[model samples]
Structures are given as C-alpha cells and as structure tokens.
Target chain A: MPLPSDIEKSFAASLLDKDGRVPSDLTSYSSPVPQSRFNIYRNNVHVALIDMMAAKFPIVLKLVGEEFFRGAARVYIRANPPTSAMTINYGKGFPGFLENFEHVQDVPYLADVARLEWLRMEAYNAADRKSLGGEDLAAIDHDRLIETSFELHPSLRLLQSEYPVYSIWQANIDGVALSSVDLNSGGEDVLIIRPRLEVLVIKLASGHCDFVRALGSGIALGEANERAFESHEGFDLQLAISGLIGCGAFTGFSK
Target chain B: MTNLSSWLDKPIPARAGVGLKPEHFAEILDTEPDIGWFEVHAENYMGDGGPPHHFLSLIRERYPLSIHGVGLSIGGEGALDAEHLKRLKTVVDRYSPGLFSEHLAWSTHGDIFYSDLLPLPYNEATLETVVAHIDQVQDVVGRQMLLENPATYVTFKSSDMAEIDFLREIVARTGCGLLLDVNNVYVAGTNHDYSPQAYLDAFPFEHVGEIHLAGHAEARDDAGARVLIDAHDRALVDDVWALYERVISSGVSVPTLIEWDNDVPSWARLFSEAQKADRILKGAQTEDAVAV
Candidate 1:
C-alpha cells in the first residue's frame, strides 16, 4: 500500500512527462476518462507555471514571441520547478537556461536580456535603504576616505555582457521605434539598482563598471580607483564617482 | 510564541472585504472605501521592503486584514518547508492579521512548487498527512490556521471518506477553523455531480472563521461533462451568489472575501461585488434580529 505521499510524487512525475501515464493505484474514472481528468491537473500545472514565467520575463516572451517562448518555458519549467513558494523568484535559473537552450541559440543576446530582467526583478524586491549623497562622502576625513570601502545598496546588481543587452531591453520595453543595433559594437556593462521605489537600469562606461564592480566586491576606495584607471585610459574619477552618487548606488561606507 | 488573542489584535468584522491588489493601492488610499477588511496573498509581501510593504502598512492601519496563503502545500506528503514557515511567521508577526488561511490542496512536492492549488484525494492516508501538516503549522505560527476547501477536478476511487467527513475529522483532530470558500463548493459540486447545497448543509459552519467568494470559468470535460474551473478571473455567477446568500442566511456571519486574482476589474466594480455581499449579510442580520 503506497502512502499518499507516494501517490502524490508519482502524480507530480506524471504531470511533468507528457508521455507518462497516470498511476494505476490512483483511481479516478475508468481508463481513458481518468486520463482526460488527470490531464486537467497536468494542464493546470503547466499553464500556471508558464504564466508565472511569462509574468517574470515579459520582455523575453516579447523577444521570442508567445509560441516559441512558451515552448522554451515548458522545457525550463520541467527542468527547474520552483523550490520556493515565492513566484517572484521563479525564474532565477531561466537566464542560464536560455544561455544553453538550443532553440533560441540564433538570438545570442536573448540570455543576457533575460539576465537583465531577472536582475530588475530582484532589485525591485530588495530591502529598502537610505542612499548616501556626495556630502556624506565629503564628510569623511580625506585621509580616512582612501582606506574606506563603501557599501552598495542591497538592490544593486552589476552585469557585463558581450552583447548590447541594455539597448535590447530598452528597445523592447520602451517601444522606442526599433532602430538597428550593432552586435559588433562591443559589449554593455549594465548597472541595476533601486534607490527608492523605482528600479533604474543604467548603462555604464567600462572604467566606471570596473570601479563600481570593485566597490561592490568590498575593495578599498583607493584600490578600486586604481583598478578603474587601469581598465580604461583617461578615466575621470570625479565624473564616475559623482555619477555613482547620483544613482544612489552606495548606501554607506566604513574605514 | 504569541498568544492567540494578542496575535490577532484586530479581529475581522463579520462583513464584506476585498483582496488587495497593487493597481488599486492609490485608489484605495484615496477613496478609503467602506470595505470591512482586506486580504492579501502572503507570498506577495515576503520580500524585505518595497511598495508592497509601504502600501500594506497604510492599509493595515485602517482595515482589519486576513493573510491568505496559496503556497503552504499543507497536503504535501513531505514535511512543511521550515524556511517558508519562518517567512510566513515574519509576515504574521508584522501584520498581525485577524485571520490566516491556506487551501487544503497541495502546491508543492519535494522541492518543486506548483503555483496553483492542486487537489488531493479524500482518503485516510491523505487525511492523516493533512492533519499532521496542519498541526505543525498551528504549532509554528502559534495561532489557529483555517484550511479552505479545494475545488477539485477529479475524485479518487481509492478514497474511503467523503470530502465533508474528511474535513470534519481534520477539524476534530487539529482544532483548526475552516475558511469556507463557497465558490469552491459550487465548482467542485458541479464537477462531481453532487448538490452544492448539501455540502453547505453538512459543513461545520460553527467552526468557520472566514468565507471566500470568487468567480470561476465553466467548460466541458472530454466526457461531455460540465466542468467548472476555479479561475478567479471574472464576476460571480448568479448560482454562486445564490449559494452565498443561502450560507449567510444560515445564521453564520463570517468575514467574507471577494477574490478576483485575474482579469481584475476596476476598484469600483470589485467594490460593487463586496457591497452586494454586504447587503446579503445585512439582510441576514436583520432576519436574525427579528427571530431573536
């Protein structure tokens, strides 16, 4: 006699695999009808999960269109069903899944766009914190500032992609009259942060990206600036620092 | 652990309420409608802080709240997720909702979570599992949790107990209240060829803490049988409203909720539905007073 858990596990297995048959011990109506009845549950699971994916990745769905996106979503869902009750975190692995997904391979930038969307979702839900202004940085002793490492906001997310993911995201979302984007125009370094209620997605220069990434990793201010200068010629430390402060990227700092 | 009375400082009034949606936050704050209370999906507020918390806090200050959960998976064959329970505890402690409820159906299996309320067979084995899970939840939350009836599509021949009897036994064992969803009764009754009224009559309304009324989608199964799907996307049909009237007139004035999860209409439209329920409840109260 299988416990109810055993039946439920088998039922879940059957839902994931279309070719799988309903468990024998689990009785519903007679043969074919039971299968049909069981299909309702199967359909509910697939449709509901797919709908969640669509909500989390509307841009991806728009990029790939409904039919193709749902097809890929079905495959991704079967491989990585949500482990948490939070549907907001459902597509943590979707970007990675898109990277290796053979079907959407032709559009190589698809995965990076998905990554940007996922980061946006995360930033939207991150903890609320007060952002530090340039005055707060100036208040610190100049000598101590060199030894200080700034703490980035809890909502901050940094991404470096070989494709123009930021433009693709903006183009799809803003519906700004789709202009041709050059794939060979190097990569994009993106900064995602929620200073307050609204999440902002900003494209960063390479040197600034290196500087922000270093600060995010807890590198000292002097050391991070060194890395930024090393990354790009004619790096403007003052401009990058002010730009970061304007975006509310740093919450506080400690020497 | 918090005392039950202290945990639920503001009891939900036995009147009509509506599910809180983000789109209506500004309107709700502006208009401040006469809704008796408000309900929110617990998972939506699980994040640390954001507009969800900001809006919910403002709403919480005014109306009594009910924290309805769709993700507890109380019917799963495995142990309840400790981390999920902790997060729920945090929400309950923060909001101190008057009522906390979850569906009897399972939404998770092992590590995978299904976003919908999946049904379970009415059998001794399943009954025992549900009882234990509810017991565990009550212990962790330190408050009684109401288990809402699920709108099932299929029935198992291996089951020995009726759905009503199964619920009765669980209530007897765990001492938890019932969150009677009348729409589920209608949906399941029509699908299974039973009388929705009979199910209502058999329900232990004495233990019902809250009630839910939602719209469902109607379709036909392969066997040419009428199937009612619990879609929660439209207005309440005449039949379900009639059923609600009967339940309210049955002398139980529970905190009723109008849920519209998909294709959500304007605040005015949703509030109109709540007003309709309020009228029915008031009518029942008048009748009760006359009899008294």
Candidate 2:
C-alpha cells in the first residue's frame, strides 16, 4: 500500500521537529530511541534550502537581520516545503509570506524588495531570443506603425512597487555603504531584463513604466500610446520605444 | 552504446576547472582562464534557455564540462525520480560531458524531498535499491554514471555490510565507474571509528574513473563521538591532501577534482588547489616512468 498523505506529512514533520522521534514502525531495531541521526539529516536539508534562499535574496536577509530572517524562513519552509528538488527557482512564495508575516509588519517594504530580487533571479534565467533591432522598426511603413502589435523580450519583467525598492536594494548590496533610507519617498517602477547574459535592473522614469507594461502585455502600439498618454500627459512614444529597443525589450513585431 | 565508450573512458587534462558558480560569469568570460573543465550541479542546467544555458554554451566551447548531480536520490526506497532523470538526460544529450556522477544516497521520499543526501542502511535492501536506480538512470542518459561514496555521519545497526562492499556490489552489478571521494572515505572512517587506509585498500581501484578531493569540518556528536562532516567548499584539510597522495599511488588513471562549492575562495586559490592535485598526478606518473 502507498504511504498515506497525512502519515507522510507527520513523518516529515517528525524528522524536522526538534524533539520528535523517527517512527518505530519504519525500522526493525528495538531501541525505541528518537531518530536523532535522521533529525540531523533533516536539519541539513532545511539549512541547505534556506541557504539557497539566503543566497538568492541577500538584500531581504540584510533588511531583516540573520536571526529574524532564518526564524521566518524556518516557518515559511515548513508551511510550504519545496514542490521540486530543483531549488534554483524555489521559494517563489517568499514575498507573499513576508507580507503576511506579523513580525515584520513594521517594515512594510520587505515583501516588495523580495519581489524585486525574485524578479531579478527570474529574468536572469528566462528564455533566450533574438532581440528586434532598430533597423527592423524602420522596415515598417510609418502609416502602419501605430496599428502593429509587438512581442516583448522573453526576459522582460516589470516590477511596480509603492516603496523605493531600488534604493533599498542598492543600500544593502555587499559593497554599497548603508545609510538611513527614506520610507515615504513615494513609489518606484523598475525595469528588469536579461539583454546579454546577466540580469540588469534599471530604474524607470515615473511616466515610462506604463509604456513598458502596455507594450509587454501585447497591446497594439496605438493602445499602448493611449495608455501612456493617460498616465503621463506629455508621454513621448518615440522616447519610450527607443528606450525599450535599446534595452532589448522587444523580440519581434506583428501587424 | 553509440560513442558511449569514448565518453566514459576518456581522460581529463591536468589543468584547473571551476565549479561553474553563477557569480563568476563576467570574470570567466573576460579572463577566459585556461580551465581544464567546468563541473556543475546537473539540476542547475536543466532549464530550457537562460543565462545558465548561455554561459554553459560559451564555457563548453572552451573547456570540457562535467555534470555532478546532487539530486538523483540513487538509494531511495521509492522509484527513481523519472522527471528529474529525464531532465538530466536532456542536459547530458545536449552537452556530452567528460564525466557524469551522482551520490550513492537518497534525497526524496514520496515527493517530500529531504533536499540533503540522506544515508541508507548499507545492507541487502539498499544495495538492491541503488543498483536498480543506477541502472534506470544509466539507461535514460545512455551513458555510464559514476557513483560517489557518501560522506556519512552515522551508521545504522541494521547495516549488515561495509560501505566499500556495498559500493563494489553496485559497480559490479551496473557496470558503473566509481568516483572515489578520498575526503569522504577519510571523513566516514573518522566518523565510524574505522581506518581510512582500510577503506582505500578495499576500494576497487580499477573501477574508479574519477577522484574527488575536498575539505571537511570535524566535529563531535551528541554523545561526544568524533566525526568529520564533508562541507565541500572549505579550505583543504592537511590530512585530505595526504589521502589524495595515497589514492594517486593506487595506479588508477583517474581525473581528480578540487571541489570547493562553499566558502569559495578566489579563483587563484581554486587554481592553486587544482595545481596541488596536478602535482600529485605528475609525481605518480614520474614514479611510474622511473620504475619502467
């Protein structure tokens, strides 16, 4: 018979528990001793996965000190154990977890910073494609330009936050000097893309984020212009399109 | 069977190879160090297309690559992870590595992946289970996979066989080569109160295709029992170097790796470690040449 789901969960929980014992039924020995060695294995697994999270999200850990970060991570891990052994992209729910966590409610921007880091990681590993060039844009007749739809680069990701997440990320970087960051400095829109082989996050101007978002959502060029115009009255379509192209944001276009 | 012989039996050059950490992408591309080969965790490169693929493609062109997997769970009670196996096979098919290896340990049980390499009782049950898993993995990848001995902390009372015997039986049954981790032998020996020398002596040297040298952390158990933990990326321990020398004397022409995945020092430090192993390989070759 297959192992029962609850029994398996209990078994895993027992192994991860600080004072829990390995089930006597699993082994043939009669010592009735606690599964101490198994607990060591369990601890190692948890620490390794936690370390991966810590590596990927260093700024998040730095925002919350080591003690609090690990404590919070332990809780998050038990609640949401990895669905796959491949942990390169695991811990996707960390940002949401931080938002709901009551301990760090004072630092409201923690989850947003985590979301930025996760987006950076995602862009770095997103699919590779041939980026559309400026010459391709010239191929279209000027009359057909606004009606054409464009496909954004596979690696393009937009992160809109109500806090200065970019400043938070920068201040906490390894070599950067730490300083008092302003919490109420309004909101920020960030553009994350892997143009070459590395993920680059560029802070977007207040009005340009809507342009990228509209373009990224596969809206027609005319509709994207309308959206950008609505948000920023004098939004320049030429400047935004050139910026997106230079950043390798569009892979191709469709009329 | 097609071109598998050349791959499994090919020799590795004596130059240094990096562990393929993502942090060094620009440095690796800029310097283009004359690295012998690059080794990476198989799971890392399983994605379809990304920076991992780009960097790997660039480096693969310049150096030999090896896929050292940590998640195969070769000794698990349940069936082998077929999806993970298929992903790994796709990678191997894409990049024909000079060597491919997995641990003689399990990591998953009914989808509750204990991401660490958990130990199994070295007995009939485990032996059969691992051998079957290795066979399945090899069949899928279409190549012989090297099995590295686990760096164990504790042994179960139900373990009816020695670790070496268990390894030998697997190799014999599956025709797989052994990735002899001298540090693991030394660490497991110290942990279990056995002789590292005896473990080495009992190892099937002819079947060892590659060797691993890494640093370990030594600590005491709850009951004050001394043991060594194989934390792979630390500074090289003095005794592990001695163990490497002893293994080189075994007359096996095996490619060795100076693995440092944690606390990774500078590129120069990793190269120096590899150079140290290179020296040992040459010394063994020199002695053999003089005897001839």
Candidate 3:
C-alpha cells in the first residue's frame, strides 16, 4: 500500500464520501484540471449504484417518488456500499437499510415493500431447475406420499410482512389505481417462485405459508399437513397443494 | 480449459456485432437478425440459469459470442477477488465465447465496489500490478483476454510514460490481445486534449484482435472546456464513425461491436448500428482484396 494504493483509497473514498472531495494526485494536460472532470468518476460511481438500486426497487421508488427515493438511495449507497461487483447482489441489505432509514418512517410499510421487491429480484436470478409438475406429484403412491419430503425450487422465497406488501406490489406493477386497495387492510404472506424463466408472486392463504415453510424445511408431507391444519381452522390440504403445484412450486420430493 | 493458441486465434469474424440487452432478447431470438456476434457484460450473465442465460444460450448458438467482463477490477490495488474470477471462468466455460475481454481500469478498492470502470495511472508500479492481474486472469480463465483502454477525464501526475507505451508494454509482457475501442480513443483524446490519430499511429495493431465502436455524450468541464463522457446511450457520432473507418483503414479489420449499455434502443435500432459497422468493414474488405 504505497504510491498507487494511497491514490486509489482516497479516490474510492471521495466517490462515496458525503462531502465531495477530489483526490490530490489527479491531473490534466492543462495546468489545473477542472473539478467537474474528477467529478465525472464520482458521478459515474454514485449514479450507477443509484440507478441500479432504483431499477431493482421500482415499487419502493414509486412509493417514495424519484426525488426522495434517489436522495435516500444516495445515502443508502454510501452507507451500505457494495462489496461485490455483482449488481444483483449489491442491494441485498437495502430492505434493512430502508427499515432504519429515518425519513421514510412515516411510511412504515416502505421497508416491507422493499423486502418484497428484493425477494422478487432474487427469484429472477436464482439457479435454474425443472420444477416437479402436479402430475409428477400425483403419480406418487398414496401410501408413500405421506412420508415423502419435498425439495422446493431454488428460487422459492416466503416473505411474511405486517404490511399489505403483496397488494402494494401488485397495484404498482400492474399500473392499476391504488385507490381500489387499502394499504392498512391486513398483513400478507407472500410466496415467490420462479420455476422457469417467469417469476410468480403468490399471496398465500392463512395456513399455506406455514405448510410451505414446513415442507421447505424437509418436514414430511403428512407432518406439514398436520402443521397447516393446526395453524388455522380454514386450512384445506387439497386446495393448498393444488395452488402450489399449479404454480410449479416444488422441484422434487423423496421418501 | 481453452487452448491458449486457439484463444489467440480470435475466431469472431471481422463483421459487426451488437451488445445484447434483455429488453430485446425475445425479439433477437424471434428475428434472428444477421449479426457477426454479440457481447455481454460478464457480470450481467453471472446470474444462474434464467432469462439472461436462456437468451444468451440461444443467441450464442446462432452467432459468435464475446464475454466482456466489466467488474474484474484487473487494475485494483489489492488482490483480485478469486470469487469474481471464478464467476468469469464459469460464464466462459458455459458459452466458450469467441472473445473474452476486460478493462485496463479498476472499479473496486478495499471492500467497496464502485460498479464503474475507474481509471488507473500508467506507470511502472501500476503497470506491474495490472500485468500480474491480467496474467492471473488468463491463467485462471485459461484463455487469452483482450484488454480495452479506458476513457478517462483525469490523468495521474505521477504517470511517467504515455498511455500507448503502457498498453504496448502490457501486451508484450502478458501476451493478451487488445480490444481497441474507437469511441473511447476519441472521448479520451478530446477530454485530455491529445491527438487521437497520434495515439492510433503508435498503437500496436498487430496485437489488436477486436474493435469497439459506440456513442459518447458531450459535456463541459468546470472551466467550460469541452469534455466527452463514454455514455453509450445513443448512436455513434459522425466523427467516431470516421475513427472506426480509420482503424479499419490501418489494416486492423477486426470483429466490431456496437455497445449501447444505457438507454438501450430497439432491436432494429441497435442491429442497424451494427450493420453500419458492417458497411464500413465491407468497404475496407474490398480494398484489402484489391491490395492483396
């Protein structure tokens, strides 16, 4: 860490620093390089991460608006500066950042909305695997099915939030008028999966979330069913399996 | 592992290619436009099998492909991220792209990744660092990579040698190919108040294996001096087109690509830019045939 090392550290620091400062060794053909020239590197770094965050969390951007969203994104980008160049993995901590981001506290549901968006992004880029279709699950013998444990798709994500995050995400994504949905209606259990290239965000029924979670954690199908039944009186095993299978949730199952 | 000799062959035909964008993925598959090749940022396709890989697989099957890595930070001050190198190798092994390339710039320092290609000074200490990194990259990826020059606004006061000399020395030491980006030369030349033609005259065209042509945004410095940003949002300006022709005229007819990373245009618009390069290359092809 000598000549170029000292220069890079300061240059990297100035890019993410709250106070805009130019590195000392920087020069131009002219006697003194204009500040704007050095600021180009600064702008490129900030603008790239900001744009990446803005693109990944569109629903959050809509809720907060561009001005506020970008302003907050600027601060978030600095505080949680990416350690990897993988833009997909850059904002994994953004939802948590928004949770404690003071200015958006009035909008208590903002962090949850951000969490839903982050999950959707994760689903989009997750590993590829052929999902176990409903027919495949049905073809299993009834006696063996009970003891079988299911392997969920690699892209499956379950998000439980106190805010009606699914509705907020759905409304914004579909470009529908938000007046139809009440933000304070109730919390939501979201099941996001991408069996193929298409990503699906499903609003889970009361007991299905626990059932799916249990199955995902290697519990036997029969035991998962029993857990679902205990979780809520409205639990219907047939309906839950049909819905999840219809959406290609499970990748495989083993006895 | 790819054979180093075969990697140096540069199998990508001396025709025009376009940067692949997800927005136009379906259209590209459906239309199957006549493109020389397609180049993608290795980081974009580092994601596991999904639409990016799905579409790239389809396109790679039809045409020659090049994987341009934007985030290896080859010129970084610290040790190169072995994980990032592994990711780059994975993508290369999956597709076996015709050309593999990265920048002469560093984007990450310490634990922070900037997500932008930050410029580095051209000097012995920095040169040793870059040469070692490129050597590590070629050894790990098991391929000959092309190193592209960066478009910079500021130069280091400590830089003892010129950019061309640094590039030539790196090529001599590492034996890697060069991806000569015409617009970058124009942009850097104007930004630094240097003659791009002079830089081109000094370039080691023998080691050059590919060409990159793109559009840059015009801006002004704080002192009101003209500065150009490598903003690949729009079409190539007439001046950059001339620079591309100049490179072709210099007997360096290589696989050219039109890179529109920001504000990506329609498939028709992007492909047409590639076609424009094809027209220029074709014109030079006829002249070379006559010369031969």
- Where in model 1 is the C-alpha error above 4 Å? A25-32
Q: Of the candidates numbered 1 and 3, which has the greater TM-score value?
A: 3
* Candidate 1: C-alpha RMSD after superposition: 1.7
Best by lDDT: 3
TM-score of 2: 0.90
| Docking band of candidate 1 | medium
Which 10 consecutive residues of model 3 chain B have the lowest summed lDDT?
B1-10
Worst 10 residues of 1 chain B by lDDT: B1-10
TM-score leader: 3
Screening candidate 1 with a backbone cut-off below 3 angstroms (N, C-alpha, C), the clashing residue pairs are none
lDDT of 1 by residue, B17-96 (tens): 99999989999999999999999999999998878898999999988999998899998878888989988989988999
Model 1, TM vs. native: 0.96
Ten-residue segment with the worst summed lDDT in candidate 2 chain A?
A: A25-34
Q: lDDT tens string, model 2, B118-174?
A: 777777866887888988988898888899998876555557788888988998899
lDDT of 3 at A164: 87
Ranking by TM-score: 3, 1, 2
Give every collision pair in model 3: none
Tell me the spans in candidate 2 whose CA falls farther than 4 Å from its real position. Answer: A1-13, A20-39, A171-181, A231-234, B5-11, B14-18, B23-35, B48-51
Q: Pairs clashing in candidate 2?
A: none
